[model samples]
Target: DQQVKQNSPSLSVQEGRISILNCDYTNSMFDYFLWYKKYPAEGPTFLISISSIKDKNEDGRFTVFLNKSAKHLSLHIVPSQPGDSAVYFCAAQFGGNFGNEKLTFGTGTRLTIIP
Candidate 1:
């Protein structure tokens, strides 16, 4: 079964602190991984991504680390801000068909950054 899992339903952090979100996948065929951030009433925006061949990827204040051996991945946000409060989804694309590589999303984790 293809299942991307986000264990924590929510996370709370004070502004300017670091925020870490974890995800797991059981499917070995997933070669592309992505993290998306969403605000209320808006679609998710791509944050960071990593291929199965790579172990880490970073963008500005966001970093994503993939541990293939452990079937796990994580997103780290540095100096978290109050504006960063939103839902985060971990998604993966599997199979050779890029067009058919449907995004399997986690249940989503709500991040709250306290001012």
Candidate 2:
């Protein structure tokens, strides 16, 4: 069963505008992460994230918000730039242990920033 889902397969945003990417999960035990995949061969790089307990987490131009009641999370990139264009993946992790956790990933959403 797919615990994490990104309903929108792609999103387009104008440069210097805000880009919001959404994610949903069925598993309540999950702690979510937003990953950026710039190329097909390389592994996805960790972006911003929100813990299961926190409602929001911000880092520079990126922010992640989590809503436990709705089982949803979102990543917002303010003033989106061309370099921000990539395939983004939402991932949910279970288990608190560092090495023993299991991560379930969504299908991924392609974000395009128009200049």
lDDT of each: 0.94, 0.85
Score every model by TM-score.
0.94, 0.91
Q: Give the CA lDDT, 0 to 100, for residue 91 in model 2.
A: 87
Clashing pairs in 1: none
> Can you tell me which runs of candidate 1 are displaced by over 4 Å?
none
Q: Which candidate is the best by TM-score?
A: 1
Candidate 2's C-alpha runs over 4 A off are: 97-99
Per-model RMSD to reference: 1.3, 1.6
Q: How far in Å is the alpha carbon of 61 misplaced in model 2?
A: 0.5
TM-score of 1: 0.94
Q: Count steric clashes of candidate 1.
A: 0
Q: RMSD, model 2, all Cα superposed?
A: 1.6
